[model samples]
Target: MPRTFDGATGPVAGRFAIVVSRYNENVTGKLLQGAIETLTQAGIADDDIDVAWVPGAWEIPLIAQRMAETGHYAAVLNLGAVIRGETTHDEHINRQVSLSLGELSLVTGVPMLFGVLTVNSLEQAIHRSGGNVGNKGMECAEAALQMVRLLAQLPE
Candidate 1:
């Protein structure tokens, strides 16, 4: 992220918090790494980024809500993989977590960046996490940086 804004140029301040799901470690691990790298590149130090891992996708929002409400982070980044299977189980988790994260951002007035992948197959998730589709983790970090900067410009 560019530190210099149009007329309000200033140092990008505040820390970031990440909530990662360990259910799909193969994919989520890569996502987590990418997110960390991106945040660092955006001027956030490693020490400033706090990471919390949860059991699975379903558990992401609860922790994310808690983190967002802490008022200690400029943004909360959530990363996970929710792939479709024979049943509609993935659908339920995806809808609830996605909606809840959205609600958390609105209610807490904090930026909740969703890096979760809701895909039809492992291949698609792979493509997104750090594959040809580009890393959603990096994308989420960039988004969080942008939103944090914008929100900082707003009146309290």
Candidate 2:
């Protein structure tokens, strides 16, 4: 038999930081709501979660990095919606934000959950935010919880 390490069960305790983009508030608002709800449901108190509102997706990484560097949070959730426009602007933002968040996670040794929605259309963004596609915010929050628990089981 082999021992398996899983985050399936455990008491998740720690403060969490959510860096949400104010752009596309129509979508980001929902994402923020879902993330907060999920965190609270998982035994995280409201005070345990801090939220920072950035101007847009491009600004998420900087704020998230600051929060993660403080070593005050067990995980950081970055939520936003980048709807593709006439140019490749969305592509650049998406790729760079994703890369930056990943790097911050590695450098800070904290779980950084990427919940940014890089969708082709507003309809698609709606679908993922809280529509039939499900809320990415909720998904990210769940991932954060799992990572927090999983990391605790690993050797440091």
Candidate 3:
């Protein structure tokens, strides 16, 4: 028989950090709200969660890296909204931020969730941030909690 490791759902025990972009306040704000609400509902105290706001999605990785390196947070959630514009700016931002956050998580052994929304329009962004599509922020928070528990079960 083969054994399997599963992330059990329950109240998580640890501190968390949310690095959000201030560029798209309309969408990112809701993301921050969802992440916080999810974390709190899962047993993380208000003070246990710290939020840092950056200028844009480009700055998320730096702040996220800093928070994760502190060894204070079990995971770091990166939230932002990069709506497609006239240029290819959104593409670059999304790729770089995603790569950087993923690499940072590997280097630090701490969960770094990519909750940024790289959507085509404001309507799409709205639909994802606590909208009909569902909140990516809440999803990120849940992933963070699961990662923390999953990692704990792995052998060092």
Candidate 4:
């Protein structure tokens, strides 16, 4: 069974940042839309949510770290798409970005959620980005909201 957090709730009424990648614009754009929509639906005000664009997946971690360090947001979401090519470059980028983002979340204690999609091709990326498999952005938004609630319960 999948994990759920229906009982989780807290003061996530304002201030969230989303760092999105410019690469794979089409895919990333849809992801952005889904994220924005989910957050809005969850009662996060438009002005309270900040969106930033980066060059690609490799930049997600750095941008997220900066956003988290600012202490201006309850949580940060990292969005990107890394579709595999003939070379292993995609693998390296996917792994590095995911790991770095995870570390950023731990080091900052700011609840950074990874929304990057590491797929085999553009088609696969599209299929997951608000397509057949559902939007990863929506999933990420939910994760960010839940993390914010969880962190709020932590002793600070």
Candidate 5:
């Protein structure tokens, strides 16, 4: 049988970085809360999780790249909200940020998660931040920890 290395689900034992977008503070704030709660519940210390606020979803990637390059954080979680507007600006922002974050993770060998909420309306954004659809921030934190553990198990 081919062997598969599965990441362990538990508290991450290293520093963590969270980049948040202030564009939709009401919504993003909820996501930030969820992410923090998840990390704390998983046994991560409050002091270990660092947070940075940027103007909007468009700015998450570069900050994440910088945080990843520092090698101080085990993983970086990006939380933002880009609600669609008349010009389809949200679509562009979402795609570019996702792509950039993906490339950063690949090149830096750091685990970076895109937790930004791309929705057609504020209602939909609210739904995912911590409402009906469930919280994506918590999921991001969990994913970060999982990836950290998985990387630790790999040959470095």
Candidate 6:
């Protein structure tokens, strides 16, 4: 069953750090917009959100990890898009970035939401970024908010 967020007794307002990749500008740009919109809608003040830019997908994890460990933000959002190419390089990057971000979240105990999109082509990435598949950035923002609330309730 799907779990529902109980915002009445948890941390609902806090700082957020978003790390975005500049590689796929078009798709990533749209994703960033979606993420910001979702965060705003969730009652997070604009000034409380911090946005950082990285060169590409592989760099997202490291930046996000640093931000998550800073103890400033309630959560960190990692946004990137890795589209498959003729070479196998895409596979390696996708795996490394995804795994690294997951490990960072576990090690830091901070909610690091994975907003990376691994797709076969730019078109597919676009579709997920803000098209038919729905906006992954918005989804990531929602996940972050929910996680922040949940984490606040955990026994310290």
Q: What does candidate 6's lDDT look like per residue over 34-86, in tens digits? A: 99999998889999999999999989988998888789999999898999999
Q: How many residue pairs clash in all the candidates, one count each?
A: 0, 0, 0, 0, 0, 0
> In model 5, what lDDT does residue 126 have?
88
Pull out the clashing pairs in model 1. Answer: none
What's model 2's lDDT at 6?
90
- TM-score each candidate: 0.92, 0.98, 0.97, 0.92, 0.95, 0.92
Question: Which pairs clash (backbone N, Cα, C closer than 3 Å) in model 5?
Answer: none
lDDT of all predictions, in order shown?
0.90, 0.96, 0.93, 0.89, 0.90, 0.90
Candidate 2 structure quality by residue, lDDT tens digits, 68-138: 98989999999999999999999999999999999999999998899999999999999999999999999
Candidate 2 Cα misplacement greater than 4 A, ranges: none
For model 1, the stretches where C-alpha displacement exceeds 4 angstroms are: 1-10
The digit string of per-residue lDDT tens for model 1 on 17-36 reads: 99999998899999999999
Q: Which candidate leads the pack in lDDT?
A: 2
Candidate 2 whole-model C-alpha lDDT, 0 to 1: 0.96
Name the lDDT of candidate 4: 0.89
- Cα lDDT tens digits for candidate 5, 23-113: 9999999999999998888889999999999999888998999999998999999999998889977788888999999999999988889
In model 6, the Cα lDDT at residue 37 comes to 99
Q: Tell me the tens digit of each residue's lDDT in model 4 across 36-143.
A: 999999899999999999999998888899988998988998899999999999999989998898898889988888899999989999998998999999999998
- Which is better, 3 or 5, measured by TM-score? 3
lDDT of 6 at 13: 82
User: Model 2, residue 13: displacement in angstroms?
Assistant: 0.3
Range of the 10 consecutive residues with the lowest summed lDDT in candidate 2: 2-11
